[model samples]
Target: MRGFRPGLVPTLVVAVLVPLMVCLGFWQLSRGEYKRVLMQQYAERRVAPPMDSTELAQTTDPAFRVVELQGHFDVEHSILLDNRQHDGQVGVELLQPFLDRATGAWLLVNRGWLPWPDRRTPPVFSTPEQPVSVQAWVYVAPGATFQLHADPVAAPWPRLVTAIEPDKLWAELGRSGFSYELRQQGGPGAYRTDWPVVSMGPEKHLGYAVQWFAMAAALFGLFLYLGWHNAGRPHGKHHESNQHV
Candidate 1:
């Protein structure tokens, strides 16, 4: 009870901050668990046999599945993902629209990363004219980290963008397509497609949780120290005086 009474100001500050710190710690813990499950799913799905466009469309979540698609590249409308790097060189990633041979639906395919041979002009890329079967892993749209500017309005062919969103691309192209990107597996139209296994792993989340929890503990300790120090009690209260003068 004595420690609980940390005066009005200290009580209000502790009430607001201590709970906030504790909530953040638990939130990180939940994030760590979610990451653990996601990592497991990615590991298992990446090795499975590649799926066709129809099968891929039916699947609920297609983040990292290796898929096999028979399609012809829409070479004329190819776009470049700006500000990409390859082997310590500044460049861009080529993203081409694909016309699926089976379903006749359009899908965006990441060809690969290319160095900026000339920053002033766009590099010329050779695209296959014939129908080709491509094996690639499914990757969703660019996340918040990739975004530097607002999604541009209707732009010319071979657009340059800071972020890639399937819906936005479809809106610009005026066609329907799969909502995910295909990181070219092999064959023609390939670039540095190798990506990190996990964006943020469980270990990193756990470390963040530890930091939040530590802050909560430190806040609790400070509150206790303030209360104990502020309580009016003499160093030798018992021996000082038993009767008033």
Candidate 2:
């Protein structure tokens, strides 16, 4: 207060911005921690032995859990998830209903991504008519599902959708099915089955947090410097007047 006089405008700007930047920095740290925990859970569940369809149906926390499936794909009502990209090429992920023979429960299985070079023609794919065994993992989205456009109410077979809702699909097909989607690991009916656990890693979040914090520090430093600089101007003028007298 003695030799520091911050202008009202600068004080107001710092008051509004500094707290906001600090809050954003902490929020990013929280997000980074959350992503770390999620990745750990995924690693643990993925390594465990694959369970059967009955066990899978009874599972409460089924994120990233492996499951063994013995079923035939219902190719007639396939769903092509739009806007999927792989290796810098535009593509769609193929999802189909598979009936588990052991438990008589239907499941929506994501086979894999397929490139659609020409929009005029549908992506080519085939289904195994006979019973086939495969291994897949339960895929629970980290956040709310996204859709560029809502699926039409009366969408026909081989539907093109931006999001996949297993419950809605099962209801439309009039079948009692598992509510979660199962992403195929590798088997007879899989194509490009490799999937990443998370889109953005924890390190990226940490980096963003650092940037926010740095910006807050820089702004606060500028505020302090301006306060001191303005205060010194009046003190220097008073010293000169006293010397003249």
TM-score of each: 0.82, 0.91
Model 2 Cα lDDT, one tens digit per residue, 79-137: 99888888899989999999999999999999999999898999898888899999999
**Which ten-residue region of model 1 has the weakest summed lDDT?**
140-149
Best by lDDT: 2
lDDT of 1 by residue, 79-178 (tens): 8888876567888888989988888888889888877878788776788888899888887532455554675777787788777787778887799998
Error of 2 at 202 (Å): 0.6
RMSD (CA, Å), candidate 2 to true, equals: 2.4
Task: Return the top candidate by TM-score.
Answer: 2
Candidate 1 TM-score to native = 0.82
lDDT of 2: 0.90
